[model samples]
Target: MALPSTTVADFSGKYVLNKQLSDESKFDDILAAQGVGLLKRKAVGMVSATSDVHVYADEGGVEHLDITAHVSGGFTSKAERLEGRVLNWTDKEIEHPLFGACTTKSKRVLPAEVDAAELQNGWTPECTAAGVIFIQVVPTSGTDWVSKQVWGIEEINGEKRHTRRFLVTTKKNKTVYARLVYDYAGPL
Candidate 1:
């Protein structure tokens, strides 16, 4: 199916997480590469987390994204703005079920790349709006991890929903270490 043509302006709303999919066996390698210890990795897998994404454009026409994730016994949030330049910010140290409490400086870039053919295959035109990418420098391990998250709108059972694809790459090899999928449950 051909996706409708859309721009960044179309991604202005709250997207709730409905589902998460990943390869369980590869979780170890993916987590260890980010400096996550064995015990912490196990904890990360046992806990369930729900993420809600909020996107909007500011007065200067810059796209902004705020992702709030609720996990077992705690929650964490990160915000980024895409305005063509690399924006830097410090993410508060938060205990993650998956990564533990590691703090680092985050770099974000807006309007990342999206495959046109992939977008046309049951994905929304708004998927192109998901070009926001984030990079984090791990202080302890000195590993640079990059993440690109995109959202595609699709109709499921006549109900409009959004599917988010998160890809994490290791800067050393530039290989995709992990891929996560999350479905939207309407607004917040």
Candidate 2:
């Protein structure tokens, strides 16, 4: 459970994936939609993940959230976003273990700014009230899919969980969705 003072608006802590509570049944399908190889997808299904998040503001007062995620087996990725005060996207090039070289960007966004309702709604009340962080990624080569994700905090089984909703769509229009739930570990 999250601390009483914690809220969707400022969830700064380390969280570990609760595989048992996460909606991972469609994870392989989402990976397939992203053109992940059969073996890679299988490997992904066996791994656990964690995210260390930091939410703070720069000297200029622009809020920023930095997330450092590590998937078991030594694979780690970092994502940075401009929070509530800014809605603009900040892009970066990363060599992802699953998606290969990709261009990604993230920003704080409102539900109306999201293209699909599935990606927009379905969050806990606090999540809807605090808004969400939006991310988009496109492989530099090989794959023809674009993945969009939304991050927020939600109440699951009475505990505040760090949740992520994924929407991966291929050039051929094959789309897949998945939800990831994480247990709050502690302050980062």
Candidate 3:
């Protein structure tokens, strides 16, 4: 049965035995008898057919589960850069002790690299076989715009029990932007 779509707050651990699938008697018997390659729900995040059930002789049994699914969606954000350069207030102001004492400086914010090729073609593997759907940043070029800060990925649910992580950064004069996204398929 398909569960309702829900946001995954976090996924990074080994969960205890929950329950075994009881709908398919044949499959259930097979599972109880001989365990399959459990933790195989890396693709769907719900290891329905991949769960293993071990029936103990006396008391409790063992249940190995590995299944999960992701709610399809995206996340986007935007921030204003410092532009070319900021004004040096000290230079325009009267000479005072405060001017000399001022030592703190603002951290420069660089423009996003919204490239055209990236926008059209998308991240080679991020948006394709990898399973990453899309990524678009600011500074999206228009008219005579040079480039943009857009990026995308193609996400893929690999073998069960394996988790996924993606790190983002900016390259320019000074580091100013960063983003991290991840999805845990399930443990086999």
Candidate 4:
């Protein structure tokens, strides 16, 4: 557990998934909604994952964030580098073992900028007051679906936790919502 005084809301640090505190059971359903194959989903669900987050601002005043995902046995599973500027969606290709090729758009936004209720509500008051980071992911092939996720610092069980809420929507209109909570492991 991290001391409350040292936690940063900037979302920079190392965090390990607290499966016991997260709605992890719903992850499979969320993946399915995104058209992930059964075998891959099962493999992902069984592994313990951790995140190494880094947030910074360039000299031009543009903020940036990078998150590297590590799975069990010390293997890096995925990494995403997001720019924190509001603009039209610029689709970029990314490949992941579990998600495969996908296009993503990400930025930092004020609470008021978020129009989706699922992504806007339920943030910790501190984060809601400061701001939030948003990510939109779409598979480049297979069933058409979109996963919109909001990242913020949430106070859970008297501790500040790194939290993410994702809403997955398919072309058929099916949707799945899930929350992932991570325990502060240490500084990155």
Best by lDDT: 2
Against the true structure, candidate 1 has what lDDT? 0.46
TM-score of each prediction? 0.53, 0.84, 0.16, 0.85
Give lDDT: candidate 1, residue 3. 19
Sorting all predicted structures by lDDT, with the top scorer first, yields: 2, 4, 1, 3
Where does candidate 2 have its weakest 10-residue lDDT segment? Answer: 78-87
lDDT, model 3, position 1: 21
Q: Which ten residues in a row have the lowest lDDT in candidate 3?
A: 102-111
Worst 10 residues of 4 by lDDT: 80-89
Clash count, candidate 4: 0
Q: Write the per-residue lDDT of candidate 3 for residues 34-147, one digit (tens) a residue.
A: 222343222212322122211112234321112232122131221212112111211111111111211111111111222222233323332233222122222212211111
Q: Give the runs in model 2 whose Cα sits over 4 Å from its true position.
A: 1-4, 73-87
| lDDT values, one for every candidate | 0.46, 0.76, 0.22, 0.74
Give one digit per residue, the lDDT tens place, for model 2 in 54-142.
76667886667676776675445434332222325767777776677998877777766899777887677766766788888899998
Give the Cα error of residue 158 in candidate 1, in Å. Answer: 9.9
Model 1 TM-score is: 0.53
RMSD of every candidate to native, in Å, equals 7.1, 3.9, 24.2, 3.2
Report model 2's TM-score to 2 decimal places.
0.84
TM-score-wise, the better of 1 and 2 is 2
Candidate number with greatest TM-score: 4
State the lDDT at 141 in candidate 3: 21
Local lDDT at 91 for model 3: 17
Number of backbone collisions per candidate: 2, 0, 32, 0
> Per-residue alpha-carbon lDDT of model 1 for 23-136, expressed as tens digits?
454555666766678887776676555555555556786555566665552324333332222224545454443444445333333333333232224444443344333434
